[model samples]
Target: MKKQNIVIGVAPTKRSFLSMEEAKRQKEKFMAVIRGIHPDVVTLVDIDDICENGILFETEKITQVVEKFRRAKIDALFTPHCDFGEEQCAAGVAAAMKVPTLVWGARDERPNTDESRGRDTQCGMFACTKVMRRFGVQYSYIWNCETESEDFRNGFDSFIRVVSVIKAVKNLRIAKFGARPEPFMSVTANEGDLATKLGVTVVPISPNTVAARMDQLIGENSPRLQDYVADVKQRMDASGMKEEAVERAAAAKLAIQDLMEEKHCAAGAMECWSAVTVLGAPVCMALGELSDEGLPVSCETDVNGAVTMAMLQAVTLGKEACFLADLTIRHPQNDNAELLWHCGPFPYSLKDSSSVARLVQGQERFELKKGPITVCRFDDVDGKYYLFGGEGKGVDGPETNGTYVWFETNNWKMWEEKLMFGPYIHHVGGIYGNYKKVLREAARYLGMIFDDADEQGVYSL
Candidate 1:
């Protein structure tokens, strides 16, 4: 597991507590919860050494923590708000460093025996939140009333998971299987920029080298392939799909392993449609299976989706999530509900259906011969959220009433109108469900605009 270095700074002040000992107690409590959440990489800033206790006379104490963390090269700051002290100090540090900050309220929200016994206690912590706002800091707060309520408990769980993902992404290494083709513009990105900004390494390899590695992959009789086949069969049976579908699906899985090793990739995206069409096999289904197996093989070698999928994996921790689903109109009359589907197979877990997976052979994969699907995308620029998608059901006509765009920008509305006037590009999208926050942070670290509406689809460049 890659480590996430998160430094937590605590405020010192006797007012928040009756004595230095009480302040220590409060700090210990918060530290205990935070350490338990992500112990391996979490560091605590001793308020005693920084400010003499839990007292804040000047912003120097907070600044000191920021400087120390900067030296240690911390990824994020987590502050346990004891009153306003937590938010105030955290906001100050964040404003200075511009690092992500999270305000954590203790899991124990129970009132103290003497609520008014101490000055600037938990209530003071709450009051100090305004101080963070005063400093123009961006922070997330999670208040849990013990680990009893499902809501608070779940929220805390999600928060910790999200933090872990942030850490994981900052330390991840990805192999960019081949050089960017001249025709694929959106796929063009600076490798060094990805490392410096997103904390992710895009290791590039020659296509010939990838092909050699993939060619070495063993077939079905191999132990790993056998296990994969058996598992697929069992899942198919459970899913209640036809026997023929199961067999074809199993073959497709074997093909993925071959491709993975041939490409020498943990994940991949390839131009395999021509080969698949020649072999009369399901290329998209293979892509979907590789994706489900923690490796997302995108068609057209979409580097952006591969990056997005990696962040999603870190966020969902391998939950049922994929980054390609359209948010187009499902029906001409009902435009509110966006259609969510892919020309390729997405995991049934995300779709929550009992349908068996099957291979789509021939040029049918590119044909717009399907039911209504939704098109959706997420964008989070500097933590400000903006996501807009609509449902568009397929209709029998040359021109479609929907648009598939990459990023949402200032001219998105105009672009949508222009695309709507043209032939509907049979639904192109990724999974959509409040994912703006999930991908935006990743993009921020990568120094790419989260919402680039004028990018004009990748092919144009």
Candidate 2:
């Protein structure tokens, strides 16, 4: 499936009693400041055509504004107060849309010596927020700052990422290939709760179907299989791998992609205990390539792990690939460092520049490049789902084996306690960015408890 895009309805608001010239000027400047955002990232649909001065002020124009935004298929509504805004009108539009809503006001100009202000954007924002509450419209807020200010830019980026995260989970579709191994009880989750509570759909893949597809490509020597093997050779050091094994891994990747497309799945969870029978190879490299290509697949049939990957990918706007890793062991030397490793399933694109990308025995091997990263786990107790999010940097450490990294969290002991006491497992979905705030807001909208490992101390089960 193609990555989703966010459409924001930019509806500037003002009060009739406010200085019209000043409000108009503020609206113009606000547009100029934010227009730098690319259309691909967030398509801006302004209300300039629906009302005079491109400013919203009159309650009578609410219907037209909402209709226009609906036509544009806006994923969120942004109502900026040009001056003390038309609170009632803005609230009406937000309540009608019923999507994620946000409101902000430019910092008001300094008041005159006699207490006369050029415009009271913040004062208006306060009034508008009260009306918004009365209307029962939930929304996000940006602190009162100039639209061009760095603080506002950070808030705006965060808001868009939050919207993307919500989009990722709403009606999410995950593919299930084979059953979870008996030993992997930690990855088990309730499909009934996922469907009934979260609106996520689980599509099961028949083992026979997977076997037939892989056999067709390898046994028949399909030309498509050769193309994929060539891609494998170009991307990594496949010379040490068996020729037939490399071909089998390539076949598995193509077969999985075909099935995901036909099944309309955004991600996948596949059994790995009997890798030889299920995928004809180790299957680690196959999973890695799929994630690099934008479809993350979790090993050991960890469906929630796949969900976690999709969530992290959404926050990055699909610009970075996600890795599902084992939260294996603490550093032998560094007090705060821990090893994040998997047999061979990390995306080659995430390899450190200093490390060599290699494929041997159908597994990937390389150290992931160091950077700011976020690791999160999705799980539940009973029917109450939650997202455990924590941020850290990939640090230097001894590398023993597999695709791996040494992560130095803010507090390793604290993080360990949270997992030990919570409904979490060793498998975590991670990506190369600090997205804890984005994940927190997303969990808020999803109605899931967000366990912030950095902020919250260990709690009793």
Highest lDDT scorer: 2
Compute each candidate's TM-score over C-alphas. 0.59, 0.96
Tell me the tens digit of each residue's lDDT in model 1 across 1-461: 12234555543333433555655666665555555654554565654556664444355576776667677665556665444344445566768766556654444334546544433344655665677677766556655344235544455445544554566556655555455445656444455655665666655544454333333333224566457656755543324445444444455555555555554444454544434433334445555566666666555555444555555555554553454544354434333222334555454344323233333331112213233332333223333322223333333322222112122223434435533432222223444334444445444444444443333433321
Give the distance in Å from residue 193's predicted Cα in candidate 1 to where it truly belongs: 4.7
lDDT of each: 0.47, 0.86
Worst ten in a row by lDDT for model 1: 400-409
**Residue range with the least summed lDDT across 10 consecutive positions in model 2:** 272-281
The local distance difference test score of model 2 is 0.86
Error of 2 at 103 (Å): 1.1
**What does candidate 2's lDDT look like per residue over 71-167, in tens digits?**
9999999998888788889899999998889889889768746756567778888888888889888789989998789878788888888998888
